[model samples]
Target: MAVSRGCLCCVKYLMFVFNLIFWLGGCGLFGVGVWLSFTQSQFSSLPLSFPSLSAANLLLVAGGVTMVTGFLGCLGALKEQRCLLMTFFVILLLLFLTEVTLILILSIYHKELDEKAKDDLIKGMKDYNKNTDLKNSWDNMQKIFKCCGVSNHTDWHNSTGTGQLPSSCCRPGTDPCHRWEEPCYEKAKNFLLSNITSVLVFGVCLGIVQILALAFSMLMYCQILRAEKYMD
Candidate 1:
């Protein structure tokens, strides 16, 4: 009987630590993506602020809050008091819910933005061809679009994307395919529509991972206390 009770107590402390580790891990991964988005948009040479910039900042804020809350939960777990544990748990849960909601809403508008991005690219090339007059000499004619590193047969696929696409690229005769590429383009339109579905999947999986971790961390601490009690 004594051994069984000690084992149960140990398990609870371990659970507390586990919960914090998973929560931090998950948030850290998302944080890098969010930071990258901001840097890519604001610091890049062609960096023009887009409507999507708002969304990126929003994610950053939410992720930060969630991470902090998770950490607090971990601390509370160590204290092993019911009130501290419950408070941290509630705060962490609310933060998670907020993040999931934003991820859903932003996904909706992302599709339309992607289409616009594609057209902008095509129009930019056409305008540049018409605007620039490099003497039209045989030498100039030979390197026309290629003057700006654009080949007549420039392949967007596998090409390094440093091109700035004007909105006019979306006009008729311009190819927008270069802007939104591959499976990402196909899925971007429907990503928001599938937000609810993604939430259900990610939420359940992440929630379980977080819960189990905390449960284990706490279980460990509980054991520590129990063993100490026994020695006493």
Candidate 2:
């Protein structure tokens, strides 16, 4: 069947919009990842825990990949280049598969992952004062999360050998308050775990978008091939 000119025009416009959104999202991710990487590098001298550092590095990689793929997709869609479209489709498909696999693995080993994260947080807390960046990071987390230590306030004592807690552990507007009884670990952990669903949802949604883009690209490529044949 012959593809209508109107249908082709619509597909072209739709793809342009989709690719534009994808490109913007990629840029945002890349910018945030770069920021995190720079922040992490500043604390290289500290005994930063692997989980935190690894997370930052992962962000950088993800951002870079997203940006490159987004550019390819935009270019392919705009120029109607079959080779670029195919390349975009392949990369998007691979990313989709990888994301699904990662989700499955994470679901299967959530408990172990949680425990590992706990250990890393404790280690980071123990070496917090060793580096300025580490100290600032810990303080900011405590302040923002309204948390104290990995497991409890006492964890700070066990980890730092210091009887006094950082002021950030105190509740806001009560700077002089001496209530070290509050534990931050549970709060921080809960906060993080609560957001996991949203992240997963976003990833799944993005994967679906990629699938649509792949299908559109492939269809358009075929249409282009047919058009060229008709011309010849």
Q: For each of the candidates, give the backbone clash count.
A: 33, 2
Q: Pick by lDDT: which candidate is best?
A: 2
Instruction: Provide the global lDDT of candidate 1 against the true structure.
Output: 0.47
Question: Taking the tens digit of each residue's C-alpha lDDT, what string does model 2 give over 35-65?
Answer: 6556545334433333445545655676678
Error of 2 at 81 (Å): 1.7
| Predicted model with the maximum TM-score | 2
User: How many steric overlaps does candidate 2 have?
Assistant: 2
Q: Write the per-residue lDDT of candidate 1 for residues 43-95, one digit (tens) a residue.
A: 12211222333434554665576576667666766666555666665666666
Off by over 4 Å in 1: 1-8, 30-34, 41-52, 106-207, 211-232
TM-score attained by model 2? 0.70
